[model samples]
Structure formats: C-alpha cells, structure tokens
Target: MAYKPPTRAGATVYVWSNYSLQERDRRWKAVRESGAKAGFDCIFVPLGDGIDARYLTQLRCSSVVLPTDGRPPIIIADRSSSNTWAPEPWQTSREWSEPMAEALLELGMERARIGVAGLKGGRVSHVTSIDGVVNHGAFAAVMRRLPNARFEEATDILGFARYIKSAEEIASMRKAVEIAEAGLAELAAAARSGVDAAALYARVMARMLELGAEYFPWALTLGMSDGSDAKRFTDPPLGRRLKANSLAQTEMIAVFGTQIAEEDQAVLLGPIPEAWKPVVARQREIFDEGVKLLTPGRSCAELLEFSKSVAEKGGMKAKVRLVGRGAGDDGPVIGAMTQPDALKELTVEKNTLWLWRPTVTGADGKTRFTWGGTVLVTEKDGELLSKRAHGAISVA
Candidate 1:
C-alpha cells in the first residue's frame, strides 16, 4: 500500500534492511534525534530476499509513533506481478518507481530535499527495488518523478548510525556466535581421514540448523594442507577427501535473526607436523596480540600496525586478509586484504561487533596459516564471541 508523503516539514530519508521490523525501527530511531515520529515523513520498504508484504505490514503496524498524533509515518513499497504473495491493499504492487512518484507528488514534495540510501558509501542492498534488483533504475525513476527534488547520498549516515549495537542487537549476535561455535564443534568432531569436504560441510550445516540458526551468509569452505610448500584453498565443498596426517582448514558462518558470527578453524586429522607447530603458534600469538588491542578508541590502523609488528617479530610475513569488520548489517569494513592503509581512520567503539581474522605467511613464503573469530568491542576490551579455542583443533 502507498500513502501520500506527509506534509511534515522535515527531510524524508529512504532506507531498507534485511533485519526484522523491530531492528528496522531501532535503526530509524538512530537515524533521527526525534526518532521515527519526526525523523521522516515516510519509509520505503523494498521487496526481496524473504522480505514480503507481510513483513512490511508488520513494520508499519509496529512502528507507530505515539507522540505525533499516534500516526505512523507513511510506508511505501512495490510489488510485481511475479510476487507469489498477495499484495495488501495498503501496499503498492506497481513497479516501484511509479508509486514512489505518486507518494512524492501527493505529499507535495515534488521539489524538496531528500536522502536516498547509498547516496554516500552505504550499500544499495539497503534500497532494493521491484524484481529484487538494486541498480540505477530506481534512483533514475525517482529523479524523473520529482525533477526539482535535491537528492543526496546518505550512506554514511546509516553506516555510522549502525556502528554501535543496541542491547537487542548484541543479544542476537551473541546467540549467532554460539550457533557458529556449535557448527565448528561439529566440524571438528567430523573431521578425520577419508572424509570428503562435502560430508563435513553437511554435518556442520545440519547441526547449525538443529540448533536454531535461521540463515547463513556463505557455505562452509573446507580444504586440506599437507605441510607442503604450496598455498592451498578450495572451492565450495566438493568430493575432496581429508587425508591422514593433513590439516583440514574450515571456514563457516552462522546466523541468528540477521546477526552473523564467523569461525575459521584448522583441524589436524592426525599428528601435528613439527614444521607447522611454530607457524601455528605465531598465528595464535598475532591473533592474541590483536585481540588485546581491540579496546575502545583504538584506531584500526594502530591495531593493524601492531599485528604486523607481531608477525615481523616472529620472522613471518603478514598477509592480513581482514583485521576485522563491522558485523551486524552492511559492514563498515576495517583492515585490508591487500592495502594496509585501508580503513585506518575508523576506530573501535564500544558495543560494536567485528570478525578479527589474521593470516601470516611462513618463512618458506609458500606456507600460510590463518585463524580468528568474531569479537565484540567493549569499553575496556574486546570480548571473543566464538567459544572454540584459537589454535588448530587436533582430532586424533
């Protein structure tokens, strides 16, 4: 259903999310000091990736702002003929642009200042259009509708707003971390000689679902390293089998509600190699050192430099994939896979979530070892979210 934009005298901000209605409400509250009531005249909900009319309806019904005449802000959404669910009378099933134009015109906002999602550095996923596509068409359509309207990219507004986690968001992330730990435990238990990558992946996925995980960002990636002088990683779990006396490297992410927890583990199918022991120890040390520095107000650049120092002191070359990243919604990524200077300006803040991953290249150059888990930044220190031990899990 569509409504004319309100005659309210504040700028309208359009945004979307894959999170629940309650989470979206919290985000809206963060976006404006007056909260949802005076934040904007309307919100544009996108239809895609499990977001449907029912979900939008719930958002509208629950997002009532009592201070403002007890009326909720107008919610606009689009529907297509291909939508499997029946459209609510209050929702617009027309191609997204048409309804957006109507709403703007009705609100007498044909020539007003507006903030669209992804105007800055935010993600387009926050503003998907009909047909589940996020592209220039939606923005172009709105431009056509309100030619005189001044549009601005408001990406960082939402990014910084979501930087700190609410108590509810933290709780969801904690549960998500627990679920990920369970999945890792399952992987460790099932990792052994003669087991194929696919089988191990299946086992962990089943356990995660059984433990109430709703969704996962990516499939489990499992590979084998035989202490050879060669870099190795694998494609999606195929039929590759774990060999005796080899290390099984596994990466998995588990989700609860929309929060995510990531775990990367190395399991030894047999005896650990003498050559690999020092490599593993140094990787652990680097991770520990980095974790200790995850205190509030610490610059990501500082932490990265410290991490590099730790690796250098151990006579290893650091190939940092991710020092960490914002964990809840669209990530305000930190660190670098290639450039060390990336995200140097962003500092750690309390109540923020991150995945601290550090990888080190051995003296041999070809051998690389890596490991880490999700962490929550507190006022004093960063709390490790995953329950598993940091080093390689040895399964004899």
Candidate 2:
C-alpha cells in the first residue's frame, strides 16, 4: 500500500506501553506535548498497573485510556497495553493485536477503507514476542473481521511529527549531553595511561551518574592504530588498558528519564595520532556542510546529498547516511538519518531541532572521525544547541 499521512491530524492519539509506568508516562507526555504543538487536539494515555494517575493528570490533553467497548473509531489494544488488559487473550504480541483488529471491525473501519492509525515494526521478522509482528497481524485480524476497515501504520505519522524537536525534548537531550560530556571530560582528566578500557568505562558511568544521568552512555571504542580493527566499534570491552598513545573513539548514549541521548568524541591520550590532524579537519568540514544544509526548506535527502559531496571532496568513501536524527521518545526513528525508503520525507521545518553527526574516514585509511552538534531550526537558519569550540575536536 502507498504510504498515507494520518487522517486523525487533530484526533486524539493513544500511547500504550509495558515499561516502567513512570518512564512510559514520561514518553507519552513528551508525545502529548509534541502533538499539541503540532495542532493535535488530544493525546490520550491509558492508566495501567503501577501508573501514577496523579502525575499524568497535569497534562491538558485527555490522558486516560478507557475500557474497550465494541465501537468503531475507538482504537483498542495499543502495542504495549493489550496484554496488560487481557493477559490470557494476549499470549504473545500477535494475540494482543487481535483485540485492536476486533475493535476496528466493530468501529466500521475495514480493509483499505482508511481512517485508522496504528504502529508497526520496521520488519515483520524483527517483531518480538511482546509486540506481535508490527501492525500486520492486528491490521489483518481487524480486516478479517470487517472487510471495509482501512488502517495505516501510526509509526510513520507519529515519527514524522516527532522529527522536529521541541523545547522540552531539547532540554531533555541537553541534560543527557551535558551529563555525558562532563563524564567524558572528567574521564579524560582521571584517565591514566594504563587504565583498562572497562575501568575507564566504569569511571565514565560513575561520573555520569554523579552528574544525574539515568544510565551510562555505553563504552568508548579503543581504535586500533592500524584501522583494520574498526569493526571493534560494536565489540564489548576487552578490559584492555589504555595505552599511553593509543587512539580512542568515544560515543555515548545517555538516558534522561526515559529518553535516549547520544554524543561522540575522539581523543589521543598521550601523543596525537599522525593521521588524526587531517581526519579531524575533514570531520569538521563535514560538520560545516551538514550544518549549512540544515536550513529551512531543505529535505533530509537533499542535506544527505550535500554531505556526500563534502565526503567525496574530503576523499572519504564511508557510507555516512545521516549525521543525526530526532532524539526524543525513541532513540533512532525520532533522531537522525531518515532512510530513502523511510515512510516520511524529512522536510526541515521551522522550530525543528536536530542533532547531526556527519562522520568520514580520513585520507589515511587508518584514521576515522565523526563530529556535529544539536541545532534548532529557525525561520532563517539552524540554531546551535550544543556549544562547541572550533572544529569537531573540542580539545581541552
């Protein structure tokens, strides 16, 4: 089916989840505020076991999820709340979707009829035991009951709307960045030449926690001098100690309440890598090109095209899809790098705040680098949120 924007532009959106009630509500509130800013009339959230109603009561929108009634236009069985409501009926995520499909059938929404909005996964194979296979099972179940029901994946709609950052969202991310950066800065000072990678990560985690972050932003990658081991980016810490002059790549994902925030930085403990100078320069150039392209009226595709030119000019061949994305409720979707096949086109809009980190491999095939910052889109240009000194390397 061709992608369609949501018809419930101003209708109430319900968010369901099985995580910490406080965290789930926080995410729901973030969306609620974003929805209101984008002209949504109401964003409803169902209260479940362990949910604190008094806390969610502060929001202006209709924040309550009512018990299911056999009625049309009433979306039942959100991805997260189905099993909570009917344990036995929802043996797995797939079963949970049936209730919504049943509800849609009762509501008169039928196959290809349209006017229904729901969430789905990136791929059916990737669906977990908890969320049943994306929206297909639920959509199919609903359609099977009522042949006229029309339903579209709500993920794209909500994700596209969330593409732009809000003040509250920005504050949440900034808090994460601040805490993470401070941890990195402190780690830099406390880092001894012989400290093990795991130990250093522990220090970072401790310092970040001290600074009030909800969790550690993961570990830093100790890049090999040969660059042959760049694959180590995803490898777990070997508990290897920091060599006096080894190159290290530091990227972090800090949690704020429930939101995930990320930042990346590189450092040379004792002696700067001979190849780092050019790599750092090229990374900075990429950052400039990316920031320049983030202006209003630019599509994310266009900005990525510009990044490709900058990368080619700098002689790097790595595929750097998007430097950044919307970092709010979800980590990846709301954040950077809208794929070409992405359901929604990332049209840069006014009041949109983005975090971009365009990366490139240095001329010396051995050196890899990345850099950028958070920016808010204004009527004229993008505003910087994470203040940094010149270039991608903030050498203290």
Candidate 3:
C-alpha cells in the first residue's frame, strides 16, 4: 500500500542519520499541520551505530511513514550502490542527484523552494564524513538539475527542533545513562597497576554490551598520567601497562537505542599524590557548581560565566572545553567562548539534554582538572543523568 501524504504545500527537507526518524516525522507533521507539504530527502542509509538498517528497509518499502500521522512521507533515498545499504529488488535506485530531481518533479515541485541539510562552510549535522559528502553532493545535484528551484539551508531549523526531547526519547536516554554508569563502574574496577589501556577498554566495553547497551557511536578515550605533569598523554590502547602511582583518566559514551550518555573520570591506581589530592578535590567542586547552574531557561553564556567563577574559587583558570550540546541525533554543539552570543540567546528548554564539561588549567598551564556529565533540563533544575559520583575514584 502506498502511504498518502497529508494535505499541505509540499516542501523537500533533507536529513541524514544524526537526525532520527522520530525527529523527521515530527518535522513533517509540524509542516503538514502548518499547511505546508513536508517530505524527507535522506542523503544515504547510515550503516553503523545510532541508526538501524531495518528502519531504512521500512522507509524504502513504504511500510512506515511519519510515526505520528501515519502519512506516507515522500522519501528520496540515495540509490548509488556505494551510498545505499544492502540493496533490495523493490528499492528505487538512482544516482545521487537524479532521484532528488525526479522526486521534486513527481511532486510537481520543479520550481518550488527546497530545504537542504547544510550550507556552504556551515556546521554539519551528520555523525560521519561520508554522510556530510553525500549531503553536499545532493545539494549540488539539486542545483544543477533544477536551476529554477529555490534552495534554503535548514540546519538550525532542524537543530533547535531536536533540543526538546519527546517522552520516548527521554526513556531511551535514561537507559543510556544506566549503561554509562555500569560501564564506568567496570572502568574503575579495571583501572589498576599492570593493567594496559587496551585491556581496560575491552573489559569496560564488553561489560557495557553485556549489560544491554545497543552500541557506542564513539570510542572511549583512556589515558595515563603520573601527576608530575598536568598533561595526559593518550593514544589507542596499545598494551602500555599502568604504574602503581599512575592516574587513569577516561572519557566514554554509551548508546541505548540511539540515545547517548557520557562518563569522564580519573581513577587513582595507587596512593594519591599529595599535590594531586587538592586538584581532584577542586575538580569535584567545579563539577558540582557547574551542574547546579543547569536549570531550565538558563543560557550557555550564563553557564560559561559560572564556570569562570567556579574555577577562580577553586584556585585555577577556567578553560572551557565544551559548554553543552544537543545529546541525541541532532548534535547542535554550543561552545563557551567561540559562539558566545549565539549561546547567550539560546536558552535551555525543559526536556532538552546536554553534555557540559568545565575544565580548569593549573598555574603551570601543563596540569589540568576537568569534570562533567550528561544533564537533562527540567522544570526546576538540571538533572544529572549518570548515577556515578562526580569526583575521581580511588581504584587501588
């Protein structure tokens, strides 16, 4: 059965993996309700984590449409053999630009305005570079195919839309937080003298999978430090054995049903150095102070200012590595200093999720301490998603 689209003025919206199908549906429904025809132009099938290939199959088969209205959304799948997933006989195959032009023409949108996923020299929405290239190529193809068609970059439109999570998305993210806590526990246990970075990573990852984590889109960064210097020399886990007095720091992300949670901590393998004790203590203070400011309606610029005060109180200079970002498929990154005005205007909405990490550089500039986690904005305050303690743990 062919899915029938809702009655509205038709517009083509481009999307990729980082944007979930649920998000796409929400956008389509909103557009339709506003008397606009909204259709999706998927740049390609995402093969790896976050997106399930079966969803692509359903989109190709027209078995499902926007989940909300059950309306068959006009979908233009990238049919280039290299761009698509495992091809099926029923799937419509076409060169990158050909199908886009065809879909618009079939919809009688040859001269109508269309939305592309990105603008030239703009922030990308997809997780992988492959999808980025596909998006850029699709844009070029559309311009070449229909010179009269109007093109608009809808990057921020889709980005801010994803900030407010639905109930279903919140549930999935809670599960992701649970898995991250479990993984952090395993990581703490595995951080010991004579343990190599590779072994630690393998053990924690295996435990996360064992505990029902679907996948991790990113790698766990594990590094070792001797406390003599502030710099943490990190590389791919290559069997470098940790010493008794070393500190192991790890930054990790665990995914549950495409929702992600982050865990970053330092574990003391042996007796804590006297000088390191105060640094760890101050890091905990900074984390607590920063998280306390994660209330609804608070802006990232406010958080950035708070971070500076926290660092000064902790006797260090605040080095804002990351302020916060959209946690799910729409990865809208908001840094502290780079885009301060944009950050100031963008207030945290209830049900929106963020990852905030505030770091402090020591007087020597070589040593640094950092802490943060996934935070969910609520009516009253920001909720820390991960149950793990905010401070570094003693593994020895």
| RMSD (Å) of each candidate, 1 decimal | 7.4, 9.9, 7.6
Candidate 1's residue-wise lDDT over 44-156, tens digit each? Answer: 33222122122323222111111112334344433211111212322443345565566556655566555443333343122223132224675577678778876554444
Q: Candidate 1, 178: how far from true, in Å?
A: 0.8
Ranking by lDDT: 1, 3, 2
**Candidate 3: Cα lDDT at 247:** 63
Q: Which candidate model has the greater TM-score, 1 or 2?
A: 1
Q: Worst 10-residue stretch by lDDT in candidate 1?
A: 60-69
Best by TM-score: 1
Tens digits of lDDT, candidate 2, 1-396: 211222232322333222344543454555454444544333222212111121223221211221122111132322233322232221112243345444433333343333222233321111112242233543455446556433333333344444545556556666766776776577677666677777677777877777666643464667554454442443336657766555566666665533355666666656555666776676676666666666787766676556545646556644353333443332132223444454245567775655576666766665667655566677788766555463333222
- In candidate 3, which residue pairs clash? 9-37, 230-367
Error of 3 at 32 (Å): 5.1
lDDT of each: 0.56, 0.47, 0.53
Misplaced by over 4 Å in model 1 are 1-25, 34-71, 77-94, 123-133, 217-223, 227-236, 321-329, 336-345
> Which is the leading candidate under lDDT?
1
At residue 4, candidate 3 shows an lDDT of 28
Give the RMSD in angstroms, all C-alphas superposed, for model 2. 9.9
Query: How far in Å is the alpha carbon of 261 misplaced in model 2?
Result: 2.5
